[model samples]
Target: MLPHDDNPLFATFARAQIRVERGEGVWLHTSDGRRFLDFTGGIAVNSLGHAHPHLVAAITAQASKLWHVSNLFEIPGQERLAERLTEASFADKAFFTNSGAEALECAIKTARRYHYVNGQPERYRILTFEGAFHGRTLATIAAGGQKKYLEGFGPKVEGFDQVAFGDHEALAAAVTDETAAILVEPIQGEGGIRAVPEVCLKGLRDLCDEKGILLIYDEVQTGIGRTGTFFAYEHSGAEPDILASAKGIGGGFPMGVCLATAEAAKGMTPGTHGTTFGGNPLAMAVGNAVLDVVLGEGFLAEVRRTALLFKQSLASLADRYPEMIEAVRGEGLLIGIKPRVPNGAFIEALRGHEMLAAPAGDNVIRFLPPLNVTPEEVREAMRRIEAAAAELSGRPAEGAAEGAAA
Candidate 1:
């Protein structure tokens, strides 16, 4: 075996030490026989949690028939998935990809192309929020406008402008005649679960309409019922001309989609864009299976109910341990807690309690549980969180003193 410090893989992520053996529902079983309640949800990718029977059966069935066939041929599954997605959203067309970054890239291209077709090729610049995170690709990193992700990536890509997050004056001032679109995330997941106000979303749509520029929403993390709605934008009442979605869409499968209005996609004619392994039969099968569950009767309502309970529980926990938790933020199952203690320390403490969570910017710990997470699971997570808080505050857990006396 490789020495602990002599790994062949690139040292990019500060990965945890736990080795997972398998996962089922909201629980993960580690190689060392430890069971962990999973709230990270594979960074919001596992919509239905690990080993969902429907997803597994769909992929398995598709794998037996066809695994891959390039975009050259007309894939029935891809067409059906696209049709369903467009029918459900504000888009008339859909383009498939393999990751959220690709979806954002495609959305960017579609926005620029819309202006290009109108005989204004110079109007290619796009405006983004200061703390936004589009993706890891060079173009997307530039679009995100985060210096940390752009620091070592050589010269930043051109034609992207950024404005202070939620600063309406700055956002309006940044828009120029050359701007093709304004890109935003309805709920900023990586930026610490910060949600844009519904009023601000409507104002952005008005500005885009008045300026004759398209509005693009990067719903990579907030789409596919991660939020109470099918898309977070559904709560804002402002529809984007283009939308980029991934993450939970495939329920852990590697897939993405860029949806666009018919008018916004006018320039994407033949030879405009394409992909190789995107929208393969395997991915389409999984994506469809995910939709079958997410769009099922009363599924989204259940998600809303569970999210409310979870958030209320977290709020109460924060109230009880003000020294450990500063604030509870976010919508639906995509929640975050700003802690008085260091986020890393809190995350470590939670891990010690056999509950997995993810760290975010702004010194927050995110809890992205499955949409179908049960009330019992929420209570169990709350117990673990309270234990973590007690340990962090240097106090014994609820029953620790009684157990010791016994």
Candidate 2:
């Protein structure tokens, strides 16, 4: 064994102590035989939860047939998925990718190419909001504009400008003759689950139309039924010309896609852009399987109903534990709680109670349970949360002392 302090892999993520062996539904089983209630849902990627039967069967079936094939050959799964995605959303064309970052990259390229084909090569700059988390790529990090992520990364990529979020005046002022697109997340996932109001989204659509620039949505976290809708933009009635999607798109599988209107993608002809592993048979199979569940009859309605129940419970919990939780926020299953104590402390407390959550910007703890989570699961999570809050507030849990006495 290596030294306790040494690791062979890059020391990037501040990983938790437990070693997860396997998972099923909303629980993670550790190597030590401990089962934890999983609320992070693989950072909101496990839409149907861990090891969903449908996903498992699809992947297994695909593996037995073809694991991978070059993008040069036609893949029927990709064609079918693309058709379904376009029929369901505002896009008319879709480009497959392996991750959210690649989708964003493709979106950025599509927007610039659209302007170039329109005979305006200089109109390449894209406007983004402050407090956004696009991705970790060189271009996406530049678009996110967070100083911490950009720090030490030499010479930030050019053509991206940032403005105060929700500030119509600043956003308008920031737009210029060189602007090619306005990219935003309907709900900022890593930015403390901040949502752009419906009116603001409409205003953005109007702004883009008035300026003849494309509107791009980085829906990597808010799409695929996480926001009580097929895509969060549907809630606002402001359809984007280009959108980057990932996270739950493939349930637990690694996949992403960039969707665009036919006009927006007109410039991306043969040989302009391509990916070697994107749209592979395996990824396509899983993507199709995920859609099979997400698009099933009444599935999205159930997600909305469950989200309402969970958020109401969280609101009540915040009211009861004002000393521990400051507020509740977010839409659908993508919920966040602002803690009275440090967010890290609250996360650790939850972990101690055998519950898992993720931390976001602005000191918020995210509770991203699987979209198919049941009401009983939500109630169980609340019980653990109450216990954690009681401990932090120096109060005995509701029945803990009584149980001990008995």
Candidate 3:
């Protein structure tokens, strides 16, 4: 048995343990029977909320029929999901994976291979921005270009260069003959819910076009209707040679996919790279179920409408308590509140009101409620947030007579 706060094989995450027993749309129930509004969305992994009937039905049905088979066998679910992804984006090919890190790793290899196939093996470097969070793999830590994550790891991986977030000239100057690709996240999630400027996205597309270097967008956090769009890149029409998608792709299930243009995919042949458990029937079936809801008629449109309502509500909240929340940023359900105080303090205050939010870098608290969260839920959440802000900052509870300033 595991002692309090001590696990033999599992590392402790933050400082809390809920032992969540069940979850439904936008609400999680702990083993003690307390309910909390889950704005964290499993840190943006639960795209369709928890325990959706369709996802449960599909996974249950598939699990009963067949759980998994080696990549050596044909899988119809993979076929349909791949076709759906390509149809929705500029990609001509796709490769499945079990997580976002693996998807990004494949993208890196594919980008390098593109250069090698073009007779430029020396083009191995990838230009990534600082304050970016890609993943935790050895190569990804290098690609993220963050020193904090790489502190304990010795002898950093080679061929990664860091540049300023929106500096076009600095980014352009960083690119050299050795540069094979430019990797960026459409929205930096973990590093903070920092949205890449549209001008910078388009400028990178233009620069990559002129230099013949591949452009890769890591949509692991912003994809699958998180930002009220099928893909965050669609917001700017800045298509990349390769795009990595995960997190929300499988609703709550684990799945990741790398979408690449035909030219880029050409570098990845049958024997060049593969994963045995990546495209198994179980994952594919869940992926299909997720896509069915995400790509369904009027589903995303409703999400966009909800996004507008959420913005109005959040703006009002910010206006009411100017000290606790500095500004509201980000798009869709993937909203971020730049806190005047520490984000950790804000999250702690939220716990008192039974609202759960995830903390990000740069003093930002990410609000990632389920994509299908209703207006009533949003209004209720706003009330709790107002109360928390008032309590945390010692401000008047919104229109209370005691503190008329609110």
Candidate 4:
């Protein structure tokens, strides 16, 4: 055995035991030539699916022209992307970063600084929701306040107050005079695909407005058309003063964006915040490509249509295997399967059937298929899921097939 055979990389991630060589569309290929239907979509990062021609062309074209430059200089691609982002959303200004963590960091800083410069320096605390995942950064982890991610990370960063998820009374009570903002995920991606109800989101907006506090949405996992809209906030009709977006924004390229209203961004002066490698030409090029596809006519409508079909199919599957599946949750293509079996075992069963899925909190298995996934692909995924469930039940494939035909 080689020295690297044991553990060459950090032991942080419990990666699936598959060695992926390349991917195209919704399929992953192993070095040994095995193909797996990938429903994870790289944890919702592959917005346009793997190796999308437009994204590839954009990245290659930019690679041939310009790549990285200091943020001190003006970047036309960044400016164009920022313009497109702001124009398509409720934001008036945009800031770029390399990942969702940095985006959230910018949002946290922007919220605090907004209060600071507005003569309310004491209102630095941010109220966050339980089961919400912002990122892994110290500030974001502290904002999330999940003990699993906060363990042994030293004293938790201050100014983050956590309230029970979706408890309007608790949220209202948690807010103090020191609260500068309320940060939340429109759809709790890692918190088992729990989407906050529209009423609750509107209530949060009302609370923030009443308290003179900012409202921030961490749309990292649910943004960029994953939820059949440009951002998940669109579903609730509640607009945030600041929004953090990443993941699918660059179509698998590393990128993050912090969008804010002009009033909310008053404190983000030249020296207040900056990034070195963010919004590079390469990342901006891919980001533009992703926008071209996502913002195209009929694209998001098709995503909604496809998501409805997928969700109905999943609902039928759950009905058929009630003993195996507890429920199907989530919106658009970001789905979660709450199974009666252990989520890890359920995911392994899907892997055994050569299908990829992601595991989430609360024993949920996430299905983050690409936004452009075809209707045929959704049907195929349902078949594979049924097969996996049958396998788990120790039943022959034909038995399940006959029952389905009935």
Q: What is residue 178's positional error in candidate 4, in angstroms? A: 0.4
Tens-place lDDT per residue, model 1, 1-406, is 3455798887787778889999999999998999999999999999999999999999999999999989889899999999999988999999999999999999999999999999999999999998899999999999999888999879999999999999999999999999999999999999999999999999999999999999999999999998899999999889999999999999989999999999999999999999999999999999999999999999999999999999998898888788888999998999989999889999898898899999988998999999999998888888888888888898875632232211
Alpha carbon deviation, residue 403, candidate 1 (Å) = 12
Q: Judge candidate 2 against the unseen true structure and give its global Cα lDDT, from 0 to 1.
A: 0.93
- Regions more than 4 Å wrong, model 2: 1-5, 398-406
Worst 10 residues of 2 by lDDT: 397-406
Query: How many times do residue backbones clash in model 4?
Result: 0
Candidate 3 C-alpha lDDT tens digits along 110-207: 99999998899999999999899889999999999788889989978999999988888899999999999999998899878889988789999999
Of 1 and 3, the candidate ahead on TM-score is 1
TM-score of 3: 0.96
Which pairs clash in the backbone of model 3?
none
lDDT of each: 0.93, 0.93, 0.89, 0.91
The lDDT of model 3 is: 0.89
Two-way lDDT contest, 2 vs 3, winner = 2
Q: Tell me the tens digit of each residue's lDDT in model 4 across 1-406.
A: 1234587786677666678999999999998788888999989999988999999999999999999888978999999999999999999999999999999999999999999999999999999988989999999999999999999999999999999987788888888999999999999999999989999999999999999999999999999899999999998899999999999998899999999999999999878888899988899999999999999999999999999999988888788778888999999999888999999998898887789999999999999988999998888888788888877877654323642311
* Residue 103 Cα positional deviation in candidate 2, in Å, after optimal superposition: 0.3
Give lDDT: candidate 4, residue 80: 96
